[model samples]
Target: MSRRASGPTEGAVELRGIVKRFPGVLANDDVDFSVARGEVHALLGENGAGKTTLMSILSGAYRPDAGTVSVGGAAMSFKSPKQAIEAGIGMVHQHFRLVQPLSVAENVLLGAPSSFRLAGNATEDRVAELAEAYGIRVNPSAKIWQLSVGEQQRVEILKALFREARVLILDEPTAVLTPQEATHLFSIMRKIASEGRAVIFISHKLDEVMAVADRVTVLRAGRRVATLAIGDSDKSELAKLMVGREVMFRVARGDHEPGAPHLTVDGLAATGDLGLPALRDVTLEVRAGEILGVAGVAGNGQRELTEVIAGLRPATSGTVAIGDRDLSASAPAERIAAGLGYVPEDRLGTGLIPSLGCIDNVMLKRTDEF
Candidate 1:
């Protein structure tokens, strides 16, 4: 592995006048960002505000149209992800990339340098040691598919540590975590930053930013709006900075008696994309005039449950009822014909055709009516 400079600097990682453009859109506009050693820097912005684009430039996924990047106070141009990794930079993307069949230790040592490599037992031992020291726990011998989202995230962290990364960029690290899991991750992130390394946490959740970050930088419309110490800011301040206006936090759920059942599922069983029993004998009911919420950590079979109910996936066993009709064995079209209106998690890809206009896409499920 390539080594960066040996001592502390003003900025562990810094970008100056960074600008990135694609056709008619300027994704990042002369953005300046810096994270110092031993600091937990939170990058905050709404979707399409250039937070990810700026980090992508730093990670070498995309080269900048203009600007300078410096690592450990030395100006550097990174052509690829490998080059950035060589310069003590590591990034864990929102979507994890892991070989499902590979063991945890194998995944950690997969792309690491020979010096960081060890045989089976040694690698497992090292992983255990790192997990203990960092407050992250995972079985080194377990395959990726066997682990939960939190455990997979721990493996990602271990991968960064194994690579000797001095600066770690985590994009929406807690999105898949449960509340308790998110707390655990925050503690682990604190440990990482306390070791005199730089940690850039990218998140849109204001509560988490306030909880974990030492410093917060808000981006709006591809520009840096504010960068302030966490102690100097509050949720409202950060929210205003992100949206360019004052915001209101209010929810009005009027009291009303729920009507008869509209949708019901009993003893629902379904498999995930990995062919695992993601939904196991789950039961739920939604009344005609009520909104029933199903909440859990990501990968806890929410998607599978939805797919099974929407008739996109075959249930291993169970009954789905919309009003008085049982649609357990029905196909998606059949379910739709039975008066079930469903919208998937991915709006652009699954809910609507990106290339089609509003009217055309709206007519997809109602072609006969159109």
Candidate 2:
């Protein structure tokens, strides 16, 4: 067995009694977590469980209500992600920060080298070599909008590599990835850990966590409940740890009983905010009680379509119909009445209110009015 195949890797990070609060809820309270150098440690929890809030503290995106963040036995306080980056820490969010029109190399080196410098072919050439070495294949010259979710994720990983991050944190990395893309991500993660870099992965998928994690830590209601070795625990065990009891994930349906379409977009064509044609006369329909997974590369027409249907963005041409009502010229209020349940890609920017509670955030539209 290799040295890294055993216990925690070297440059360890420790969190002691961390506490974070937001209004009525304690997001994280006295939370303790540690990642040994070169270990692929998993943080598992349900949505809104505060796993992300804890990671945010470590990444300098949020200041803990109270706690200490010590890395490699050194005491340090991070005021911004810049400080964390300088300390060799990097975070890749579920929603990518890459500019859709920019090339992969440009995205990786956006703030690297000198902005005044030309960012010549030499940088992209180096990026290609590094990507090949790391088994992360992404076209340096290709636009971000053209690449699939998985490929774009690889680009995000490469950004950390370019930034010289030793402790890498990925928040819900596979949420938008296909099975194949997720497999690629796992391979890359294993490769990264094998090279003596610490990897902290945040996820809700228990199977994925069990598949990749050396040590799985479960958090519930903003508290760490259990941390178990992957080899010793099964899926049921981890699920128990996550939710405090058994939870059924699968539900059987009686028949193929999809109701009438609740939302419809016919021959939707739109000009992007930049005055370019965003959608390509696309047509689709979404029924109530159904989850429509629009599979495509980042920034293709998926986001534009969602926005147009949500009444967030207006289409140049094409009609959006909710039920039997054509809502092409209708505002968001009108679309809502037509039974549109839209979840925008930019949830932070478009969907939820920052100062609102979770339940309040959900009830904002109905509760506020009624």
Candidate 3:
């Protein structure tokens, strides 16, 4: 574990000798990270490389078995997320924590200490001003459920800024955004950094890191591999540092003819959670031995369409045919019996029980055998 030289004026946010251990895994091994004031630092790693765990410690979600956290050149110990927020550290998780029924302003002020004293319109006005200043396009009065995924992300940022966070951490910030929306978010991050606030961006996409980050730190197998300035490093070098070897960016594939349609949807229409039109006359067909990707921005009826096809959501009008059988009106189990397998987005909550073992979870779909 290599150590970086640290001083009282080292950076706006700094972690020295961070070490965290799970049941049998050393999640973080003496990792040292720092972000200067007005800097955008990117944290890059492969899956299970201990990036999230390291940030969780800095955000007060977990205590480091060994290390010191400092913000604004002062040593600090955070026992909870609130403590971290109060000490100028705030984190927006990949999975948003906004309440669906609440308006953007309300969600931003949900846990605020002065929320009870602030007038409703006053809160909205303040939120609007903040949004405008940061160029974050969002309606403060709009309900979370009514906003697109990008808009919801803005609300999360607004919440952190409203709390006066000087060190903002975004975990996989662009995971659900469209290309245009992601560009807009990058602009917002730059604006925040320009205002003398530290922005720690955690992502797996090297292209985004190169595009938006001033410096990046790579972690591999619970250890810090390297930290380099954007100008001094390239994607290929970063990839090598992350995985300990050169990576192939391209693959050659042989072309093959697609067979007859295996699954088909005709004029599918469904309503969203708010009873608003989500899928409007959507139609598509999937051929055998071929992959059909449903590409769109989030909250564009993708979930509703999938649910309707799996018989979890009733379609207002449509026909879903698996092979030659019409399974539009069939139950989920019936659809499963018809050779249709569905993997929901919420894997832990909907697809399987977290407390159950793998065998028990798999047996959930084969209960009839018992």
Please give the lDDT score for candidate 1: 0.88
By summed lDDT, the worst window of 10 consecutive residues in model 1 runs over 1-10
Residue 253 in model 1: shift from native, Å? Answer: 2.0
Could you tell me every candidate's TM-score relative to the true structure? 0.89, 0.77, 0.82
Ranking 2 against 3 by lDDT, winner? 3
lDDT values of the candidates? 0.88, 0.83, 0.88
Query: How do the residues 1-370 of candidate 3 rate in per-residue lDDT, one tens digit apiece?
Result: 1112231133888899999999878989999998887778899999889989998998899999999999888898989887888888889998899999999999989986563336859889889999999999999999998998889899999999988889899999998998988989989998898777888999999999989988899999999999888878999999999889999888666698889888999999999998999999999999988889898877788999999998999999989999989888899999888899889987866899877899999889879989
Clashing residue pairs in candidate 2, if any? 9-37, 10-37
* Tens-digit lDDT string for candidate 2 (97-202): 9999898888888865343233469778877977998889898888898997788888999988887788899999987777777888898888888777888999
Better of 1 and 3 by TM-score: 1
Clashing pairs in 1: none
Q: Which candidate should be chosen as best, given TM-score against the real structure? A: 1
Candidate 1 displacement at residue 311 in angstroms: 1.8
- Scored against the true structure, residue 14 in model 2 reaches a CA lDDT of 90
lDDT of 2 at 196: 78
lDDT of 1 by residue, 259-294 (tens): 999889999998898787898999999997898788
